[model samples]
Target: VLGLGNVGPLAGKPVMEGKALLFKRFADIDAFDIEVQARDAGHLIDVVAAIAPGFGGINLEDIAAPVCFEVEETLQAMLDIPVFHDDQHGTAVIVAAALQNALELQGKELGRIKVAIVGAGAAGIAIARMLRALGVADIFLSDLHGVLHSGRRDLTQWHKPFAVAPQDWDLAAMLRGADVVIGVSVRGAIPEAALPMLAPKPVIFALANPDPEIDPAVARRLRPDAIIATGRSDMPNQVNNVLGFPFLFRGALDCRARQINQPMLLAAVDMLARLAREPVPDAVQAAYGLTATQGLAFGPEYIIPKPLDPRLRQRVSGAVTVAARESGVARR
Candidate 1:
């Protein structure tokens, strides 16, 4: 971890520490959360490269936007050890897994859904790419300004490939018939009225931390058949990165992988989706205060495995390790 300044340090310190704790608790993988106050991306890369020899893998926590992409790419190229930006890939894996299960529950296919992702930041871009890898074709990506289309003058290189042709639709208009609406943007961005405009039984992943685009309570009242998820523990089917990153890093480290590649992430997504379909263990049910009648089986509410479920380490790590070897990125 690096960038221990500005919002990065304050927002990222606790998250990195929590991730370290999860790695230790679940997989018996030792991790140390180190914060660096580098002034720029080049300096941060140099600092991390200097210290890379001591660690098996480098997990980039809350480094902001386009800088995070450059840092991860440079470190991956320079170092033999795996360099993973959790904000991008971690959220991507969890969202993919949850979306898979949600589609199954709704009797829909990934290839057939219209996805409207609000927020074209790192997570949103990664999610769109991962979904594309999973066979989702129609993706509508938007930021605060409007939809990301090819005609936009302010488009970045990273956002170019995902951009669609110019359209008259804003976020709300785009949601009119969308099968899935993924929110990685700010709080209360999706109005409650827009919830009813979605296709029937829509999957809403309101993944903004601490707050969501549309409150789950409000969404349920409007579209009772909709499957809702958020980046929150208090809610059911929370699309949390913790559920992905620690186990992912564990697998990468164990395999001595050179990088966390796309195939590895897709494998993790498949494993998570399959894990959700399996019967919930007694211990897991007890941990979440769920009764056999209420939660032992898979359904709309239980789209993704719980964070504390003991089987996650073995399932996700095994899938990722195999993917690393198959993708020719593993050293051992």
Candidate 2:
């Protein structure tokens, strides 16, 4: 995690603590957090490359983008071990999984949806790419300045593909009639009044960490038809990357996979979506201390599996394991 901070031992990105506390708790894989002080992308890449042999895989956490892309792509290309940038792919996997189920509950199709992603950083860029792969044609992305459009000369390779017409330059403008508003930007990026501009039954994923762009409670109040998800656990439909990374790495390691490819990622996504549709297990309900009346079953409130769901280890890991073997990326 290049953005590793000294605020505390657990300081980094969201859920940043020695590869997260849940890695061992959920997947039974020994995980530790390593904070590195490096000069540049070359230094960062060298550090991981030197340490690559000590682990089955490397998860790039909290590393900021533009640089994140360089560091990760370089490491992945050079290392036999699967080099995963959780901020980019793991976040994308969870967001996509949650959106699949959310849109399903909302009676919407992926191909017909209009998505506005606020935050053109690594997570936002990866989400846009994954959604495009999922058949979403209309997508607009916004950065700190404004939307990525033809009028912007500062756009990079990552931002260029998702760029749309300059018709909508801001969050409020881009969200008009949009079927989804995915906020990976900073907190409060999505104004409370801007949510009303969305199309009916909009799937809103305010996935910014610590605090989301829009509070889930406020989103629910503003649009009863809205299916809202946040990065917060206290909220319904929490789009936690924990739901993706641990299981993903567990399965990839189980198979001795060479890389965490797109097929394996999409496999995890489908597994998550399907698992949410199944009856909530007693253990899962108990883990959350949810009563029967709380409705643990799949709905707008439960579009993705709980991060603590015991089945995630078997189901998501198994799916990725199978995908790894099928994709011919596994050694064993």
Specify the highest-TM-score model's number: 1
Alpha-carbon deviation at 297 in model 2, angstroms: 0.9
lDDT of 2 at 25: 84
Candidate 2 residue spans exceeding 4 A from truth: 1-20
lDDT of 2 by residue, 1-332 (tens): 32233343235534456466778888988887777777788998999899889999998877777889999888889999899998899999999998999999999999998999998999999999899888899988999989899878998877888877766477678888999999988778998888888898888898777778887788889998898888888878888888998999999999999999999999999999999999998877887887766759889889999887889999999999999999999999
Over 19-99, each residue of candidate 1 has an lDDT whose tens digit, in order, gives 788778877888898888888999999999999999888888777777888898899899888899888999999999999
Candidate 2 clash figure, as a count:
1
Lowest lDDT block of 10, candidate 2 = 1-10
Candidate RMSDs in order: 2.2, 2.3
Output the number of the lDDT-best candidate. 1
